[model samples]
Target: MAEKGMWPVYGHNTAVHLLQRTLPSPLADNSSQRGFGGPRHAYLFVGAQGIGKSTLAQVYAQALLCTEPSDRPCGVCRSCRLIRSGNHPDFRLVAPVNREGAVDRSAGLLRVEQAATIIRDSILSPLEGRYKIFLLQDMQQANESFANKLLKTLEEPPAHVILLLTATERTQLLPTIVSRCQVREMQPIAPTVIEQALGQHWQAEPKQAQLLARLAGGRLGWAVTQLHNAKFDAERQEQLETLWRLAAANRIQRLAFSEQTAAKGSQPQLFNMLEMWTTWWRDVLLAQANCIDACSNIDLREEITRQAAHLSQESVQKYIQTLKRIEGYLHHTTNTRMALDVLLLQLPQIV
Candidate 1:
């Protein structure tokens, strides 16, 4: 269950304030108004992954249906509880699914059939709640056909129907669809603010919170998730180990590793691993400059320092550039095997 009171959000306070203000005020005169308040029929939440865009959207949906007059979502009312428990009669969430019916991170795709269902469902009156909400997660994953189907609904939505769409970036969506909704761009939270929230609100230990805050890259949701997810740390450690190994690997060995990674068919995971390598090289550059404390991989200062001495600053910087180029191509139309092979060849061998 979500924490009681106002929405339980940590970072992106500005976006939170906008949502609180734009959402229907619960204190309106009941006799004069039929519902809580009039809210925009369509909203597009734009932000990076793990930035709490979906969390804010759900909280706003609760506000649209909560019966309390002063505090919306009272987090205690029948409507609030139903929504939280995923038993709300009028709430619908559409997301991409794999063959097993679970969310697929690497190859997520929202089909046109799902959009058609949403369009058909939007015309009906709410069965229980005051408003009906249709939230589409990862709208960027929707194909051209899906976008066209959804666009029709956004163009002329029912008064009681609220459409919420979340995406990593606005450019990933069609301009016509974007124009039909109110866009809310969420920014990353400051490290200090995240650290303070972890310690005071989440009750995290001081040292752990500080480390998470620094490593989260201004993403509070990511930091908070790390606290509860033991596997997150393990995976990160594995990535760091892979980075150290790759730096010392010869051409034949690196090519073999690349071949194995490309066979996994998990492009997103591979991209993330490469991104970590990029960050590691950047840290090495900082170590070479004697600014080891400023590195994102703060826990690996001694290792970075030792590796920095084996390679010149020019090699470290160039490898960082190469990793970024590879990342850019992988996101689009590029051969994964070919790209990874090139990337492996560029890794500097230790002296």
Candidate 2:
């Protein structure tokens, strides 16, 4: 998880240390608990899913608003507690909201109304902390109109307001939005590091830790979340097993499975399955090429290795390319059934 006195943000030591160095040091006798040199007006944290972009942003926000003596975020402070509980007046988070007002990331769209509110509220002075922080989670989902409306604020943010944005990729956002904020590209955590943190911090069993670490694919947040979600783990195992079975299943059988998945019509879940499928083949490719060390699904290496031996390098490469194209296509269209059926039709049948 986290280091002592700091937020439970594991990995990204260099980024963490760089962030800590900017805070006002009690030893330096600066009354400004916020920072020595003022923090940037806006920051954009970019990475893949569950890669700690939001968590890292929240930690930085807490550190800025902490009222404790320590330079780092004291999780026990009123400001820190409020931030954690999402009750802090100074810390406002703007994400895509459903009709129910709950976050619905699957089909969520960050509206222009939310953008307007953020821009309007940003001018006010802080209520509790020295600075008001606006956490814009998942900026990529915002339309171009929303991005354009918010561009002015990013270009000239108020001194007392800090905008923290998270996105899967910088390219998904407008170039104008990307250029205004300081960008932090978080890297994947090594499996070894993840295993240690799980064992030492989360008290994960040695056997369990090793598997989750490998499955995490360098995402500490995913590993930590999965620790408590046994049901999801079981589902993942079933999905992987189903993926393998597809290779041996007849075309009609595979198409039937695709039909079943398409009926569910779960965009996020569909994408997740595609991603899992992509990684599975990639691991097989790695195993076939004798680069087993580079394989992510270590616990499933035996089955992956067997398939690697059965599949040709050229066919594997072709399928990987097709899957990539399908992924990009699915993102732009709503024809989930057809897209998934196309994917199933392209599957390489096992001998």
Q: Candidate 1: where is the Cα deviation over 4 Å?
A: 1-6, 25-38, 200-203, 288-290, 312-314
User: Which candidate's TM-score is highest?
Assistant: 2
Worst 10 residues of 2 by lDDT: 26-35
Model 1 clashes, total count: 0
- Following a full C-alpha superposition, what root-mean-square deviation does model 1 have from the true structure? 3.5
lDDT of 2 at 144: 73
User: What is the Å distance of residue 311 in model 1 from its true position?
Assistant: 4.0
Over the stretch 257-302, how does candidate 1's per-residue lDDT look in tens digits? 9889988878877976886787788888988998888887777788
Residue pairs in candidate 2 whose N, alpha carbon or C atoms collide under 3 angstroms: none
Candidate 2 lDDT at 91 equals 97
lDDT of 2 by residue, 80-160 (tens): 999999999999988887756578766787888888998899889899877889999899889777789898788777777
lDDT of 1 at 177: 91
Top-scoring candidate (lDDT): 2
lDDT of 1: 0.81
